[model samples]
Target: MTKDFKVIDEYYEAGRKALKSYVTGFVLAIFLTLVPYFMVVNHALTAQNLVWAVVLLGVLQFLVQVVFFLHLSRNSRSHWNIIVFIFTVLIVAILVAGSLWIMYHLNYNTMSDSPFNTNEGYIPQ
Candidate 1:
């Protein structure tokens, strides 16, 4: 048997209001995303510049959405919740970094010139 606290209804109300308050921000984030995507496809931005622009803007927009919609501020979470969030973020960072490192080394390792490489092997004819 679970006990339903009286504050549950208030929590639900706050969640609803927060969601409603951020609809405009959500729409703007989507618009910003599509604007850069279309700009790149149209050749308005060079490939290298577009890559950095997209990465920075994507990260910026993600942070904006998180802050404005999720209300994640210094006081938002209790100590336990903050610790959990930090742990989860660290795990995600490790996973992404490790995957990138392995992938980069694999590509680097496979690029060396070697006689055993099938394309460079001796002709049998």
Candidate 2:
């Protein structure tokens, strides 16, 4: 029947689109990964710039995996999954940021030149 044929065509189209999305995502992820690797391996960027570049590429790669591999989108019917994922990401980001902030302050406050370090005899001239 025509209806059956139409359904098959729709499925085929959907499959083709999914395949394209996966392929595109894969290529983009690979390119993003390689860019950072090459930059680091070749020492093309200064330390600060390299760190920023790698962070940016890592974020992009995460997005690519989420959108393509995880099949997350605004139009998805299951909103709960996306909501949970976002919540998890927020929690993780908060934890990581807090940890980094704590570590940085500790390092800055406890440096050899700091009054506390010198007073405590923790740092030798």
Candidate 3:
């Protein structure tokens, strides 16, 4: 029957689309991972540049995972999930930045040579 054929076609199309999506995501993830590892193993970049590269790749990998594995999208059905993910990312960024800032300041202020540090006097001048 035509109805049966239509149903089969729909399923076939859906399966093809799902397969394409997964293949694309897998390839991208593999490339992202390999590039970073190669750079690190070969010392292909300076320390600062390498760090940035790895971080950027990591972010890309995360996005790929979200889109492919988690099936997140901008569709109305997934809008709430997107919003929540963004909020969570913002909160985590703020927390990490604040913690790093505090640690840097603490280290700087507590250095042995800092005149205002109470412990500075205990060290032999």
Candidate 4:
């Protein structure tokens, strides 16, 4: 009996295509990233618009980079890749939330009674 299995050239070709696509997308994303900077310098975008534009495009660019470059899928490692992805997301969420919580506590809630309040650093007038 002869084996009918073929070698995996498809993945090579697919990987090349994916790499090309990722590079193109990364270039485009870089261009988009520069837009807000230019707009802010020229006074074309307001502060709010500039920030929102950068944030939205940053998210989009991140997804693009992940999808094309990372090639994450349900089939990968029999779905273990998804588990890793989930873990990474959880870590990022926790980091962001923890930072915010700590900053809020140290800045406002916990410092509410400090002697550095208001009357300790002034002079006479």
**Model 4 lDDT tens row, 1-125:** 12322335666777788778778877877876787667768877778887887788778877766665676641457487778888999999899999987766556544355556554223322
Clashes of each: 0, 0, 0, 0
Task: State every prediction's TM-score relative to the real structure.
Answer: 0.61, 0.82, 0.78, 0.62
Candidate order, lDDT descending: 2, 3, 1, 4
Off by over 4 Å in 4: 1-16, 74-78, 110-125
Task: State the C-alpha lDDT per candidate.
Answer: 0.73, 0.84, 0.84, 0.69
Of 3 and 4, the candidate ahead on lDDT is 3
Which of candidates 1 and 4 reaches a greater lDDT? Answer: 1
Which pairs clash in the backbone of model 3? none
Angstrom error at residue 79, model 4: 2.5
Cα distance off (Å), candidate 2, residue 42: 0.4
Q: Any idea what lDDT model 2 has? A: 0.84
Off by over 4 Å in 2: 110-125
For lDDT, candidate 1 versus 2, the one ahead is: 2
Model 1 C-alpha lDDT per residue in residues 49-74, reported as the tens digit of each score: 88888888888787777666655653
- Lowest summed lDDT across 10 adjacent residues in model 2 is found at 116-125
